[model samples]
Target: MKKPTLRLRLLRSFLVILTPLVLFLYYENYYAIKIVREEVSQSTSNVLSIHITQIDRTLDEITHYLLQQIVTSDTKSAYLDMASLPETNGNYTLAKIKIHNELTSGSTAFENFHSFFAYSVKKEDFIFSRSSFTDTNDLKEMLGEYVREKVKGQSFSDWIVLRYWEKSYLVRVAQASDGVYIGAVLLLEDLIRPLRGLDYGDRWEAILLDTTGQPLTKSVMSPETMTAVNRKLVTNPLAFQVFENPADHKDYLLVSTDFKQAPLRLAAMIPEKSLLQRLPFFQGVIYLIPLGVIVIFIFYSHYLRKMLFSPMNSLIMGMRRVVKGDMEIGLKEAETEELNFLITTFNHMVSQISHLKINVYEEMLKAQQSEFKHLQAQINPHFYLNSLNIINSLSTLGENDLIKKMTEHLADYFRFITRSHRDTITIDEEVRHIRNYLEIQMLRFPEKITYNIDLPEPFSRTMILPLMIQPFVENAVIHGMEEGSKPFHIEISAGNCQEDPNCLEILIRDNGVGFTPEVLSTFNQKKFGDGTGTHMGIWNVYRRMRMAFGYQAEVTFLLGEPNGAIVRLTIPAIGAFHEMEEEEDGKADDR
Candidate 1:
């Protein structure tokens, strides 16, 4: 496993020591709050139960009177009896008036009732009723089918909360024989209105729900409280739940109870803040313990930042500066022991890096010098004697002009070979040396050799490996020429390579016999030579380029269009690397 940094280790240690105290205080506070919420919730739920019971008793009383008057009397309701008789009967109108008066008189005793009605199953209409708000025709339109379904000899139904004519009511009905229904309906709001007077705390609300968990009354509920009550009612409808309101952003205790005589649920919502307001005075002192821990934790964090992290930041910045090649930066001495050790180690590392950079640069310069001297050694002494023989043959032919030309070519060739060794020289000097050697070949083979040199003006002074192109040209002349009726042609061309604006391309092509398939395969695989000294010049050139500019040296051998060999070389531009080196050296000088 990787070891942790000093900052990470220190932070973890601090948290390990601090966490248990925080959790203990938090648990104590949580335990006390839980105890207080339970007590307040129990008290509030009992009070809500009593309120539900009061509503049930009031409904039960109204239903009891209706049941007795309609079903248990010695006579069925007079209006119900008259509904079964003919409309032409003499007592029909009188019975209607008489029974309506009785219903109105009975309804006055229960002032909470919105209405009372007796339905006539035979007539399919209400024959006795007490409601001034809605006329008999409107009542028949609303409750006509409801009355018929309820009075089919069933005794009664539990009070069901219903919405009628845009108003919610608590409706209870009792069947009086097969032809009559005596039912009482009181507005549901009137039944729950007493809840507003009861106190849990300010902004408390109550909602009336049916057994299916649908709210029948939203009057006392704020939209936020009603939403919370409904969501809690889904999971557990008969007990208490706590929920947070999104709109008001406060916790509320929801108290609910099932009704025995009514098909409804009574739920009340009181603020959790109010419930906690009833906590004992000692709880505040308990709260201060956790609060004090938070204050200490914050103070410790600030102290750690100043003592440890601030110094660590300075070390990190110094490391970044070195990575970007600024080797002159050093961190200040830190106050802590661990940080001081790290800073001293860091400063030592940077010093070692500076020394290593100088060593590598010196080694590269020595390598370049050794490769140039190696190229000078590659010149064959036999070739010098061959040039002398060529000059002797010219003299034997009694051609003074050709002899003078051959002597000058031989002079130039040997002069270039014996000159002082340089790591780099101009493209102009290298090209001049190549031209002089090719001219000596033309002098020797006047009719058989012809050459073209296209050296553009722009790259003449571009610094490149000394004698870089000469070896390849020498190889072409020695290995590529064949005895032919057609004149052998050698073409040397130079231009910019696309990889960099300063990168140069040199193409040396010859109309001579190309390599056999086996030799081409060896070149293609980059196995430049066998164990013997075959293709030594090509091998030497390729290795020297790699040593200097790395992979930017590209040498490719291809078969020409009909029968010649083509050597194409792409080498890196050296100007940019040297310019960067110069800048680095100048920075070192200033430091």
Candidate 2:
């Protein structure tokens, strides 16, 4: 079996030691940090709730005081009477003076009162308090614009906080019984007085936000810090949340609580550094543990690389050489038993592979030789049987002159076949053999058989396996002859094929009885029948050609013109002696 790779071994070792250590450290740190954050958030939330409640109560008092001033004032009835009278009436002037005195008295009665205005919708006139900073025209325009734009068309009275002259104010708008709009404005700083009095730490900041989440009091923070806080409020409004500030890359806990009596949110922001500083053990040991763990991991990794990775790198190099066909390579034994086992196994595998390759090569040669001898044996009996049959027919006729000529041709044909122990012969030699056999057949048939040989000189020297073409010629002569001497004509021709110039095409055709439908289908389907005469001859030729040239050889049978058979043989045009010489040269180089 193959041994585990060095990387796998090192990973196993590291996981056994490092996994639990890392998990323990992570859990411990997470639990401790979680406890600290929860305690801090809870404490901060409680304090911020108290401050928010105080601010809510203070605003409630302001709302009650504004409502009382509007309800108890006698100026409300006098202002309605003045708006009902004409501009020229003497009582209108006296009543307007009385209303202005009441407004001035109400504005000064409250602390941090900015201004108060009473608008008569029917008369298009505004009455201002003495404490108003702007002129009556500006106050009238401001009040008219506020009613038209901010209040829209609603007539209900409600308290709202707004910014005027770059300062926040708590404003209450009420419609008096006389159909006049009365507005009272107080500075927002006064409403948040209780929150300001609370003792938040130096690192903590308190803010009062209006209903729209805008800071009501003046902000002491930089623009970037305020922007970060505002972005957090957008996602988690009216809730306690913690986030990291982009400006300083430090964590801050934001505790936000909504005012129960007003549309306002109070927030307290405290830096996490200050909160963690209050913890007993977070300062010293929290940093040292991770640093020590990192140091240990570094030393452990270095030791593993020295003992494991270095040896594996050598083994990898040896494996690459083996892949490149150098099976003789072997790695030296490593210090560990597992590594030594891998090296020893690799060496033994290479040795066995070398032996198997040699055995496979020798077996391939033996199989080829055995097949060649078998094909050679198959050729002789078939040819000899036909020759003997011809001789027997001649003797029965008692035709000595014709028999003498047939015997000479038969001797010449067998002499050529026996002379060559090699598998291949030149096309010219094969054609000569076919001519000898045809001459013998012509003697037997006399004037009934006529033959023609057409061979191009260029294709005469092309190599082909022995006994390839003679079988087809023999078949045509024997089975294709007609009765009553109807002139059986056999034509043998060879040339280089036009489509593939490297290949030779030899055609043997006869002008005699053509193949029947059944026989033609058998040949076309390449299914040879099991018989001793013509069937075995054609099958032997087809098998030998395929074995010798592989895909380069083709044997086809067809009907010739004027009702006869055509046999075509296509094989590669390689010279016999030249191929033999090349093979000898390759063998010498190998040695």
Candidate 3:
């Protein structure tokens, strides 16, 4: 399976974290709404109870006033006089006038009472105050109708709420004497006046309803809401209830309380929306909930991207570059300590790798240069002995000119060899030294040894390790002479390598015996030590070339045609002038 991208991984991680958080927020919001609703219901119920208490107190006052009127000495005396009087007597008229005066005075003291009346069964007459708002006949007719409908079978002093004309009234019927009935009319509005002081908001309404669920006073609720409430009250007529309005589908909280002194239920209806609006804190929580979630998500994404994803992506890219051999690339500092530590460690590792590469290259160059110097030192003694033998033979021949010239060449060759401090020399210098050694050999065997040196001017100034090519030339001369019957002819040539312009190619060919199969196999295997001294010069040269220039230099020994040994070598064409300049700078630095 393919690995997920960084963006996909981050998204997955965010989802894994966000899913549970969203669920938690949802549950928290649900619980908060529930709690708010419960609190609203409870608060609304308390308000309702306050209004009910006020209504109850007002009714109690009204009841007290009516009771006071009933037991008063004036009212009792009026009832007794009306009972004792004859129908045609003038005292009966005076007694009825006194009763009327007493009822009028009592009604005047109470602001709620619209009127007062007394009925005498013995006189078969209705007596009431002339100060009453309605005609005496109308009042008597309303009282008679109210008694027949709601008060006939009820006990004396029972209060009934009834409508007279188009207005509602609270009336209590009482037996003032053995045959007398007294009733007082109090307006329903007067009973409900205490509720008017309440501060229910615009979306809330308070209403007075009778035991039959009939509204006794005007209500702010729409007709549809009232209908729903009435229907709900039939089955679940709780003191407090919350239900949705069928007409608008808005929730409403209802709180109801019964008046102890009256057959009325006081109910407060408030929209659930209004209750929530009333609490500014709750409204803020509701509005801020979604905003808070969005804000949290935004901040969290940015934090993860900046502190986690971005740094990790950079580190991964840096590692990829490192794998591709780009040690120069580096990661920037990170904000978090852990990431910073990783960046620091990676940078240090790259630095160490770069340093280690340089150290290894330098060490290899030193080892190769040391080996070349040691091998060159060993070859010097053998060449010196051969040159001495050739000079001794030349002296014995008594050819003065030849002896003087050969002596001069031998001195030059030895002088070049003794300059052990010089690890490298120009191609021109090496060629001159090789020519000097070959000339000495030619003097020893004048006709048997012949040579040609074909070095171009362009390659003359190229620098190489001293004795690198001379060893191969010496080897060709020594090994080829063993099998050749004809005069040994050596050809030395130099040119720029065709494949690599920076490298110089040198070819040495001699008409003589070539390398044996075992020697060639050892060279191919790059095994330097062959135990025999004959292969040492070639092996040393090959090893030095490999170590000093590495893969840049190439050396091969092969048989030329059918009768000669051939040696070819290539080395980097480092200019002598540049090397000399570097040496001068090094010396200046040392000084």
RMSD, every candidate, angstroms: 12.1, 11.7, 13.1
TM-score of 2: 0.57
Query: How displaced is residue 519 in candidate 1, in Å?
Result: 3.0
TM-scores of all models? 0.56, 0.57, 0.49
**How many clashes does the backbone of model 3 have?**
0
Tens digit of per-residue lDDT, candidate 1, span 118-212? 77667775754555645456666666766656555544567766666756677777766556666777777777778867867887778778776
Best-to-worst TM-score order: 2, 1, 3
Question: On residues 1-591, what C-alpha lDDT tens digit does candidate 2 reach at each position?
Answer: 999876787777877887788778777876888788888788778876876666566556656655664576575557667768876788877777887787787666565456777777767777778443454555566567676564456764566766556666666677654656677665667656655566555666777787666788876766788777877888877467777877678788887787776666776678877777766575455666678777887887787776667667877887898788777776787878887888788889988887887898799878877876787778878888888898899999997887888778778877766654566667788888777787777777768788889987876766677788888888887788778748988898998888998788899999889899889888988787543555887877777777677888887789987799998889877666468746645665776
Question: lDDT tens string, model 3, 434-493?
Answer: 888787677667688889999888777666767777777776666678633578999999
Q: Clashing pairs in model 1?
A: none
Regions of model 3 farther than 4 Å from truth: 1-47, 50-73, 80-93, 104-113, 120-140, 148-157, 177-179, 272-278, 317-333, 340-591
**Candidate models: Cα lDDT each:** 0.75, 0.74, 0.75
What local lDDT does model 2 show for residue 189?
73
